[model samples]
Target: MAGFFSRSVRATADEDAGSDEAPLRPIAASDAVRRVELLDSFEAAGLGWFWATDAQGRLIYLSDNASEKLGWSDGEAIGKPLGELFIPERFDDPNKTQRPLVFLLSARNSISGLNVRLAFTKEEVWWEIAGKPQFDEKGRFTGYRGSARDVTASRESDLNAERVAQFDPLTGLANRERLTTRLTETLTSYRNSKRACALLTLDLDRFKQITDTMGQQGGDELLKQVAARLEQIVDSEGEIGHLGGGKFQIVQPDVDDRGALGELGQRLIQALSQPYSIDGARAIIGASIGVAIAPYDGLDTKELVTAADLALYAAKGGGRGQYRFYSSDLKNSVQERRRVEEDLRDAIANGQISMHYQPVVCAKTYKVQSCEALMRWDHPENGDVPPAVFIPVAEDIGIIREMGEWALNEVCRQAKQWPVELRVAVNVSPMQFAHDDFAQTVRNALTNSGLDAARLELEITENVFLGDIGRAQGMFAELKELGVNLALDDFGSGYSSLSYLRTASFDTIKIDQGFVRGATEEGNNNAAILTAIVGLADALGMETVAEGVEARDELELVTQRGATLVQGFIFARPMPNEDFVDRLANGQQTYEARGPAKYRAARKTVFRRIGLIHEDNRYKVVMRNLSKTGAMIEGLLEVPLGTQVVLDLGGGQLAVATVRRSKGALQGVEFENPLISDGAEGLCTRHRVSPYQIEAAGRPLAALPQDPYSLIMGEQEGAGSPRQFVEVEVGTPKPGTGY
Candidate 1:
């Protein structure tokens, strides 16, 4: 080390040493001792340290102070490579722009402002180093000399500031800006390979009510709890970003399978809906998620985010606590919903809203004992709008409170004309039930109608059990005091808590239609579930009503399971109040079960155009009806049975099916694999055509472009092989008529 230090005492030292004169010391020989002292003082004061390396880039000299800092004793680091002393870290670089120390050394280039980690430190030690290559008067490579100072503290502060810029302060999750940058980069890079990614936009339900009542501090705490739960749920599969307030976004790269996405969306909804402990008080909130997959829903971050936001609007508009996948039609749904909201404000004034009744017959006798009141809206331009469609819209527009009050008063007024032996049940919205004056409103309705309180039944769903459990019990008690039967509606479907039955004095339990839908099918647990619910109700001395028994088999199963009352289409579709009154006046007491004797796979009646592919040809056909397993198509003449074909349901979904039955211009084709929900209102396949296939077919890789199938199958028409079936033009099926 000492000999190496003398190797460069003077630039011309090498030449001078061989001459007759001794070496010409650059600092005058008298000051040479003082120069060494000054350098020693710099090290002792911890201002900086000096290092020199041999021509081979091996460390020849390191100041004693620096050696001690590295826990090295007496020249232990003397022969190590200079690069070995500063290991480049994969950790955040204060400025993401720095050449590697080794690269600079190997190139014999000057290095400056380079940040590197100390290779052998117990804790991270960063250094900002600068070095210049040494050479003799002849421009030959010599090793280097450099000064280094500890920059760990300042680097940490810079990194912390960078983290602050990227993360949400309250939740410690990535902020929207960071997530947007990540999404943009992912989509841009994946465009060439056509990889799929799904983004989920979610926000808390009932969050506004919390903020209004609990204040911002309470709301912030709830948001924190939600963020923690999301971290636990998402783990490493994706990144979560806090989009401020109660909203959040998630980016899952390389994921587009609808089934998995749907499952994860549902898991998020359920987990977020669970009770949260805020400030030592229990609060309940829910989440609604909207999912958009890249290359399908949208091609870029802006398109994808807009699609996801639209889907979220649809989800919240459909009903809170649900998830919906983005579809092109959802573009119009938002505008339509806005119109619905505007029209609904005038509905009450224009008498557009009306109440109808459906009979609930005794399960054993089939005698009509109670009739549930249902709200229906008949639009002046659109005609009758189903309650399922407009009710959610009404709820979102905040008109449900007014609508509920009107319905309660009208139901009571109408019940006054009915026989006292018969009861009238009205469904109550959870939002309406949560209001402070709900019980008082009920009292006013009963008093004004002059109807016996016992004849009015209020159906309250278990969702009302969310938030303020003690308050819910108090409301239940107040309603019980009015002598109206309080039925626990949609049992076993929501907030499935036995504690509800234990705490509240409910008069009856209405078994959810979901359990009865496929209860009679072989290997289904719904039947067992129905039986268990009835037994529990019986043990609790509460009457049970089975809802939505649409078939004779469904009715028989619920009756056998000891359900006290049955309400569904098999009894009778909801009828106008005048008709209901006429039927009772004319002695129509019992409703005979008239549906199909045995349950078949439930088929949704659909009337829409779809592509039918056979051989190398595609024909347009009307899908008359669809089920998970099969679909019936029209507009094809004399289709032979046992023929395999594909149904192009759009969005890159191609279902392979075989003709199971055939009639003139109509055929029933059974799918080889059952269809899954598209995470909204439709069915879609689990897989879509890969972009790789499109690229292989002589097309550029891009987001899903329409008519990609045409490329896959070659040109559609204009020449080719002979056609098979005759294409028959079919008109739209008239309402209430079978094809």
Candidate 2:
């Protein structure tokens, strides 16, 4: 074959030579045959393959070796378009500047080391192909001749290296570098078109406890499970990336609506907080998320990330297992958190903390069976501080163990003074429970207070199981030996694991308030969950307590579900020790279930000034408490019922509400539409005043300013209208006025 091709090439050269040009020399047939044999040996060695295309860009020739490697018979790949046979690699280059293969073929340009995938092959095959355009004597396009080498092996290695650089090895999610690049590109592109994007930053709560308890291998496995859950929840909505050490970031484009973002955040929290089974051991963890939307929270990547971080810090500070949206006040909240952390260290030492008790009653008899001890703080300068605010700070500041020990001792002493039948349940922190001498500490408290071990119940959460199983079981044994009852508090709240019940001996299970709050609502599976939990407890010979039974309907549901004990405001609120003792001494042991007929949305107590817009007038009022569907406000007098008003809650959040109940200076207003979670423990309106609107109102486009209402009002001239009612100062009251 080579001898014949050499003669033909000489003949063609002779034919094309002009009269003035020298004729080309023809090779000897013997040397030509030797060269042909050498070429055949090269093709046989599988070093490369030769291919040719006709003027029409269709394959005319394919090497026999290449055809065989692709599982194709001889001449099978011929007549197909070269572009169709081999497609350009879909894995984009980091620079993202490569031209399409079709364009190069159409332009008949020279291709050098162009990597492509063999589309016709059953197995994945990559080739490094090089070709040059061929022309006829008239300088017209004729065909292309190319050589291709199988690069599947080298390409696989390259891809593996790229994956290591671009993704987290343990979780197989995008790494920080890749996420940063993607975020920068997305923000740049979205900026030009005025599009919106949302970024959620999340960090796992109590992850450190898991890492310390389980080995690093266990932590890695837990992260893989977390990544799987995140992927399932996010699906195709956005991209998720691991930011190292239990932190993750998600970018969802065209999702700036607070309602949708809030829902997504909540789903993530719920999914991550579920129990994780790693290597036959049960683990529970929680997630805190911070969300920031483009053009409102920030306009650039750096600013947006900073905003999201601040929001996440606030969410974790508010108490983990929640999400928060970026707000202007978060900066101040950070400094306030720092101050609170410092103050918390002194709170325990100065005796500013106290324990209050709420009774848990028998569901059938309504007789007080036990009381759960709750921690309360009275800051010297800041006044009363709720546990939700100070407890997380205490945990972070390394004072929770001290505080927990104090509470245990105090509760035991108080319980000794009560009737022998009444038990005292003290909540134990995971940090304190993991201590080497925790059981000993409990024993000492019991002995010192002269409190019977049978009457002392130590409430523990699922987090205690996150550490060494042997240690946790040993602690349980020690506690049991001391004769104290053990109850699983906040059961089904984090990592709801039935396996724990099998492995650890729990005397009781306290149902979380989350399930109880919505158990009676239609379409809520919590009612069924309650029944199942009660049955499970019964099978285990453990008592069940229904927590947070705030309404008569909820009480009825729990009672019907056969819960052993009921606890919540429907019976009574947590009272000071003095009040509790006084009531016990008065023999007020039985209480009637008196509460609202049906469950209502939980309300948050707040004391902040807000702008109340009525018609063209804006009045300053104080929002005393807020819920998803309504709020109680003060400072406006003689406001008629059903009067429409808009409440400016700052940061561009405005809620349209109507006065449902009006009194002398206080009114209860119902929202026209229900509020949504602000990604944290707060409620917010679905939509906010857009920066575009502010720009159109003659201001630069920027984040929400301090006074969005003033921007909307655009400088009112004069005292617009006479004050309809006198403004009463907050914290002051008229002698005869009442709400």
Candidate 3:
């Protein structure tokens, strides 16, 4: 047997010795003999092999087991470089420099470990390699030692765990965590550039309803279908992520084209709107998309998501199944609505809601034919709030009826001051008309203001008929009896019928702007519908007012279709009472004669009446109803202030008239016809009755009441006693005038 120290070699470090590289004590020959014997014993253990290489590419030593592992005898491996058998790339620098094992030599030398997986002797086996520096007795550079083991089973287990974490198990795409990480990265990049991206937060509308009807598994199947569709839509231009549950997020990066985004959003909406067959049960689910654009809406991942969520809420609130852009203004609208709710409650108590006048002009003549009564809120702190923002809020709080009443009263009061030809139209909220007292309210408004019932036009939308039609009919009949003109606003857009027009007591049907705006398009469907609607209204004996006449072509088309009145930007936007008054004054100075076809061309052949008066200095008028051949005069004032007077009838049927007598507005006038036929009795009998009859009709003519002061308030609750309205004539100045 060999002694432990007999075969051991002495180690020495000729290089500078650092504390980490201290010299090792020399082993006795007996210890060396024992070390060799121990290495020989390990070689037989079959636990794999160990090899050592010097800092140079030289193999310093090898365990006896290396020969068995590599199928080579120890003598065959002793002189070769270890990397030749293991590492694919060897350090062949002239300096022999390497990392980790380079400084372990007195001469130029180095050692490096090979990092690789290998099947050295058998293709079925895998191994991991680890190498370290070895030293001699004096801590001088000697070699490096390496060891490796097969770790395929452990690594495979860890890899499976990682895959489970990073991917959606159902779709094999990035899961919520991975998607969120990508979102964070995307947001980080966007933050530096101030560029924009749109984050689409999509949730299937009616999903809960579907899920309830279908089982949870069915819902899962539907979600899988949605995911597949989303993947196809995203393609390579954008990225989409499943946000767990049924929600998903699509990020469109570096998108400058808004049209492209809109198109994409529409496509997504359509795609997600399709029905899915789940377990042979066909169920349709639509998506409500909320898009939040970066830079415009938010700067960070969280903020974008939040804005998207708010947009989603808005979409869902707006009847769902639609997409909406993230807008702070819309959010501000909501907050403003809250304030309006509070203000409306206070308004009801303190009566702060008032009415403002906006003149509606005739498109052809640019004359203020009517004025729409618009609501205005005077908040002590906020100043005047627009009706667009607060009206809906008022409707929500059930106070619009009171507000409507106030509007009617204000309109009636203001109408008394307007030119006799101009009408006052007040919009009646649906809530206002829903009550049984709506008709009574209008009657009271007329009675209180002393406004001519014919001049007060009440405007209601098609939906107003939905509330108790029988009651509405009764109220409408009562309103008709009071001589108030009733207009069904936005008419062609709803469930409009000839029977409704004939039986509902509506005097006018205001065609919706949507139809009228497109009426001029020759081949457009809207144009055809507009033509038909106008024809239908005319046939039903209801006058039509075409709204939104923005183009001359549209106005021409509507006029051709026999639209009795037209109002839009093509004419003029609404203006105040004073402005309308000024317009009328200017119109009087420069009279523009209307064409015969446009003035009063209703097929019914009712006479178009205009009162021409010559007044005295007090401006009291001797009124005359001019006929085709003659004039019937009734004098309230002895002489009308204006020296010349003209009657405008369609077909240029103007008749010049002079004041004959004035007995407190029992004025008499004689006509000098210029447009009608030459024979006086022939013209009178042909048109209708004679001048004597027309004069007799004005016999009880008292002085026309003065126009009342303009009371601009929203609908007022409770009944008010009727007040006398002092009508103010424009040509004559009246004392103690109030407005």
What are the Cα lDDT values of the candidates?
Answer: 0.84, 0.86, 0.59
Model 2: lDDT to the true structure: 0.86
Q: Lowest lDDT 10-mer window, candidate 2?
A: 1-10
Error of 2 at 202 (Å): 1.9
Choose the strongest candidate by TM-score.
Answer: 1
183-222 in candidate 2: lDDT tens per residue? 8888877767777889999999988888888888889999
Q: Kindly list the per-residue Cα lDDT of model 3 for residues 1-739, writing each as its tens digit.
A: 2212223322222233457767574646776544664554454475645665665657655555545556666467677765555423233221243332222223333333333333256643334555666677898756666655445576677758976987777765567786676677776766555455778888876565456556677777778888899989888777777777778888788763444565677788778765566765556566777777665456667777888888776565454556766545445545655666776777745767666655555535655566567776777767766565466556546676777777788778877766555677889876677667777888888888888888888888655554235666787887888888888888865345555676787777788987865454456687677778778877778777887666666667777766777776555655555766676766642223233222211122122234342221112222234444334433233444333544333121234555454444344444564222211111221121121222234422111111100011113211243312122342322332110
The alpha-carbon root-mean-square deviation between model 3 and the true structure, to one decimal in Å, is 26.4
TM-score of each: 0.87, 0.84, 0.40
Greater TM-score among 1 and 2 belongs to: 1
Model 3: lDDT equals 0.59
